[model samples]
Each structure stands twice: as C-alpha cells, then as structure tokens.
Target: MKRIPLLLASLLLLAACTAPAPSTASTPAETPAAPVETPADPANAGDVHMLTNRYDGGQYTTCLVPSGSYCVSKIDYAAATAHSMCQIPGCQHTTSDCPVLSAGHLLVDGDTLWYPYIVHSDSEYAYALAAYTDDITPPAHPLFAVTHYQTDLVYSVNVLAADEEYLYFVGNSSYAFGGAGPNGAEAYLFSAEKSTGLQAQRLRLDTLLPGQNAYWTLSAAEGRSLYLQYSLFSDNTSGVYRYDLDTRQCSPLPQLTQNADTLGTPLCSPQVVYDLQQGSITAVDVPTGQSTLLTDTFPTGDSYTYAAASFRDGWVLSYSLWKEQDAFTHQFFRAPDGTLTELPQQMYCDARGTTPVNILDIQNGLVFLQYAYDTVPVSSYDYEGNPYTYDTYLPVYGIIPLQDLLAGSQNYRKLTFD
Candidate 1:
C-alpha cells in the first residue's frame, strides 16, 4: 500500500463525508469444511503498516514482478519459495479472472486473509473490504465483504490492525480521477466491527487530539491500542499519541518527544520507542517513560551520517558513510541479544548496478527485504523539445533466515511467482 501525504484542509467538511453507507451486496459465507483456528489473544498480532508485505504465521504479501500487473503471493518458509495465490488451472494471473490477482495490501489473521479493493460499476466506484480463507483452494472466494460503499469521493483504505471484534484502518479521500473537490484531501481513522456489515465510524480527530493543522500517521499498533505520531505544522511541534481501540480514547504520551532531524523517522513499537540521534540509538520504555541506551557504536565522525532506523523483532540501523568519493548507505542488524552485525549492502545486482535492499518486516524467524532492478529506460520530449529520460524499476522480494542474517551471512533466497 502507498500513502500519499496530503495537507488537511477543512477538517469538518472532510470528516462529515468520510463515512459512506454499507452496500447491499450479500456477504459471502465464511465457514469452510475445515476451519483454521485464529488466536483469540490480540498480543499474537504485531504492528501492521501500509506496506506491500505482511507476515503472520507465513508471509502474505504483494509484489510487482516483470509482468506489469501486481500479483498477490505467499512465501513458504519451509520450502523458501513463493507462488501466486491464484490456483485456477491454466488461468493467466495478470487478468481480473484470476480470483486473487492484484488483491491489495494483505493482512493474515490466523485462518483468514483480509484485503481492501475497489469495485467499479458503470459510473460509480465502491471501496470494498473482503476476506478469504487461507488455504490452497482453487478459485479462492472471499468469505465476506465487510464494508462496501458507493460514494462521490474516491476512497483508499489501508487495513492496519485487526482483533477479534473490530478491524482498525486508516483511510484517505480524494476526488475521483484527480478532480478537485470543494475541500482538499483528508485522512482519518476508522473502525469496523467484524460481525456487523455496516459502514465504518470515523474517529473524530478534532475531539480525539484537539489540535489543528496537524499531520497524523498511524505509526504502530500494540495489543489493543494504536500509536499515532503527529506533527503540528502551526508551531513545528511533534509528539506521539495513543488511541485505545476499546474505549475510543486518545491521549498523548508525555515520555516520547519527536524532534526534527536529518535522520529518518523514529519507530514506536508496543514497548519501546527507538529514536536515533547524533549517531546513537536510544530505546525508551513506553509505560515507565524510562530511557535505555541501546548503542552508540556507529561511526560518528564528520564523514558518516545517520540515515534511518526500523524495528520489527529487532533493530535495523542504516547510516551513510563516504567510501571513495560517493556516499553509500551501510546497514546493521542489532539483535535482541544486543549483538550487532553488519548487513549486506545489496541484495542482488544486474546490468543496472547493485540494488540496495530495504528491511520490509521480520516475522516467523525470517527477514523480508525488498529490492528492485531497473527495466528499459523510456525517453520523451516536452513541447519545447527538451529531452527527458526515465527508468522504471521492478520490485523483487527476498527472504532470509533471521539467524543467518544475524550471523552476518548474505545467504538469501529470491521469491518468484511464475
């Protein structure tokens, strides 16, 4: 899933039109002959994001390969291989006839895989959320359409976290086909019940945070709460806020402070808030507001600068260091045991040169990375006859055993879906 940052204008008007009525389409049957048991405890779920990849017991993700169409895929950890979710015999996976082809961002909750998609009919579009059983069944059918709408605004919803009762999501609205609306683009938090097929209720940002001109991002999700990081554009102040899923309450965490920096955004896990400052990493406990020094061992000289840091099961710290004359990003993995190991700079290389690898997620004792290789370059000219050239990069997903990665080994397997 991709998040396009848009300035919030006319919050009241935006919020009023955010919720659309549920569609009349009948819900699909959810019961299978043999049902898989999902954990009742919310703690089993990790933080979800608007990313292309998500991992529960196995890897459920989407990737754009050499083919122009995006394919929904699953990575088998035991076999270290990937295949498309579509199982229709002799069906081309690129078209809409394939049941699971191009399914949007995926979230695996025990036995079910949930995703959001758009349904276009004649002149109207409906943003619909659906789910299917996670099994090797031919012609997968959705268990149900949880929420559906035919509204004037174009809806793009990203499913973030789900529990036993409700699914939490963050969505934004825009005019259809880039047409301008009376109000500008807007984003909001919403929650929908699993049992009820009703339109989701938009969580009031004004009543929840009581602020104006603030930009919000759903940073992380813990057991029953979501951690939102917000920046006040009015005064240039930023902080982390917590929203409870059950009580529908929002409160700011005084212990956490978001400071502007050249380094990337700070990561907030359920227990720890990992912040990078001046070539050092600090871990702050969320409950007690206590701070612990994780490491300051990275190069802090004039030549090296901190780039970014990400946390899943552990920490992946990225920084830039001058090599000969060009600056290159160097990444390191800090294990839960306080051991730090340098990671490989590139996942693989072709004629386009070495492609840098990014840590997507760490789950089920595996590390998921996303890399890309450039395709053919396209050249075009403007009306003024000025020449312009651009290259399109196709994304590739790879997986590595977490232990091997921590041991400083680059033995990774590329996932392929034929």
Candidate 2:
C-alpha cells in the first residue's frame, strides 16, 4: 500500500494560495506611488479567497478554534466579531455532533453553504456533498455521494467552486493495494449539478490538453467560464487556461502564457488576473488581455521573493518570502489608485521577531491572519551530532479591521469558540 506523499499534498495546498516565481530580472529599489482612488467592479469579484467565501453580505470560513476541533465561523464585519455558526447550546465543539464542525471546508454559494463529507461502510467509502442553510436545520443525509470500492484507501475530496448550475471539486484517491498504477494515486476534477440528485460527473482534462499529467486549481470563475491553473508534471511547466463550461473548450491565455514559467499562480479579480513576475506585481486584463504594471517598487533584494497576493474591495494585498530569514516579509497593500502602503513588519512577528504570520485573506473590510501563539523552543541533534533548535507554536486564526490595518494598527481579534 502506498499513499500520496505529505510533501506533494503540501505543495498542492501551497499552490492554492501562492506560487513561486523564479526569474533573472534584477531587483528594483524605489518607493511605491502614493495612494489614489480607482474604481473596481464589485460584480466581477469571485466567491473564493483563501479559506473564506463571501455570499450575500456575509463572510464565512472554517477554522480550528481553541477547542482542538475545526468549526465553521461567520465574521460580522460591522461588529468586528467572529462566532461559530453552530447555534446548539452547550456544544463542546470538539465532536462531529456539532453541525458546523461536521460540515468542513465550507463553500458559501448564494443561499446555501455547501461542503463535502465522507461516509464509511463495511465494504466501501462514499464521498458526499451536503448543504446547510441559515433558514433551515442541517440535513441528516447528503444530497449526493460518489462511492469507491477501496475501503482502506486514503483520499481527499474538496468542493472548490460553484456556479448557479453546478459545483466543481477535485478528488485525489491514494490506493492501498496498488490499483492506481505507478503513481499509486489518481486525481480527478468532478462536477455535480445543483438540480441533479446523487450524481458526480468526472470531467476530462485530457480532452482539453492531451497527454499531460497535471493537477488543477480553480483560480477564478465567471459566468460560464472557469480560470484554471495547471502544472504539467512531465515537463515541469505551469500556466493558466480558460475552460468554457458551455462549449467544453479550453484555451490558453496568451498574455499569461508569454511569461507562464515566471508568472506564478494568479490572484484573479473579475476584471484582472494579477501575478508576481520579475519582482513586480503585474495585472492582465481579463477581457482584452491588456497588460498593466501594478507596482514594481516593492522592496526586492537577493533575500526576498515576491510570494503571493489577494484582491478584495479594490485592494491588492501582497507579501514577500524572506529566504535567509525564513519568514514572510515585506507585506503591502496596493490601493486602487496604485498607492503602495507597507504593513509594519512587527505586526507579523513577536517582540523578538521569531514567529511567522500569514495573511490568509482580505474581504468585507476585514483582514484574516494566521499565526503561531504560545510557542516553546524544542531542541534536538541529528545523526551527525549537528544541533538544531525549533520552536513549536500553536497555529491560531484572527482578524483585523482593514481600515485599522491600513492605518498601521495591530488590533488582532482571535476567532475563538468562547
């Protein structure tokens, strides 16, 4: 029996948020332009960002609270508070009995909150889809289920994106008895229609791009089209492709394709697809393929790599990875008018500047962050008697008002079960 290596799983997870861009372009040292006002289309913004999704006027996310269990929580931007979606009284929130806890990896679409859950039987395992709503109680049974024969296999099924008609997901199944060929695992893209009952249709990526072993991540969805980022394992090449749901056709975006190898995974808004390339943030118009330089003045040196970006409320948030320092460094917020404002480094680090913080998502005038807390140092030695010391920190989720973040305030409020 063989399983998907943890490193590969981790790389897939990282691809969901960021992509590494290695280039020969020289580093630039110039201050970013001052803040100005630019308008963005609210209708064009997609439903996905980091681990949270926006629907109607609310923001929803699944997070691990202090209770040692994952719980789905809703953020109230007006009140600047986050509380578990579960309303059951006296719930410890540490068991599947909690409705919100059970429905993991939530995707808020329209009036429904959809999630994927697994069912175990004596002979087979069922990967299923379930929905939750504010106006009604949680359903006891899943609306759809896909059965697998290998009961002991290791697998992951996640709901990636949803439109009015169908929900799209990626499923990876690791065979326990060598059924998945040499890789020992298989990846698939599936779609389940909202109106269809108990059905999951596997999509053919091979039909779009032939003879390539690749995995996909849904970067953005608009109307009848889906923007997918794919990495081909055969040649170690990566790029973005537009897949039309209506025509079942796929085409490469030439503007993005030109620098595909250097252009990392994109942060897509309705009107633009932004990528980090050659130490600068570049935006490509979705409709016209017109390229625009967002900012090139982000502090780029030999030690830093422009890591990732997220767009929300007309603001583009980006960060750089510090190679030598082993931390996420040089965080910035690019206003609509192209004004680049640097978030103080202290906000992401402790007094001694050891802990690393990740900017998870920005939405609804709020900034979601994940960092380690209550850390303790752990030291050990290798087989060659080499000394090594590392800190063990518990990861925690928190939020900061977007206005406060722009104004250089570190008023972080932890999303706790209490």
Deviation (Å) of 372 in candidate 1: 7.8
Clashing pairs for predicted structure model 1, backbone only = none
Q: Provide the RMSD of all predictions against the true structure, rounded to 1 decimal.
A: 10.2, 11.6
Each prediction's Cα lDDT score? 0.51, 0.51
In candidate 2, what are the lDDT values of residues 1-418, reduced to their tens digit?
A: 1111111123243322121122311111122211212112223333422223655334666666656556667765445456677778877677656766634445666667665556655654666666765532245656666656643223334535665555666544433122333443334445555665423433433311223244456656666666655444444444555665554556666445433344444334322333343456666544346666767765555555554454565444455565654765556777777777877735323434643356667767777776445565779998999999987555566777778877877678875554
In angstroms, the error of model 1 at 175 is: 10
For each candidate in turn, the TM-score is 0.65, 0.67
With a 3 Å backbone cut-off (N, CA, C), the pairs that clash in candidate 2 are: none
Residue 286, candidate 1: C-alpha displacement in angstroms = 5.5
Query: Compared to the true structure, candidate 2 yields what TM-score?
Result: 0.67
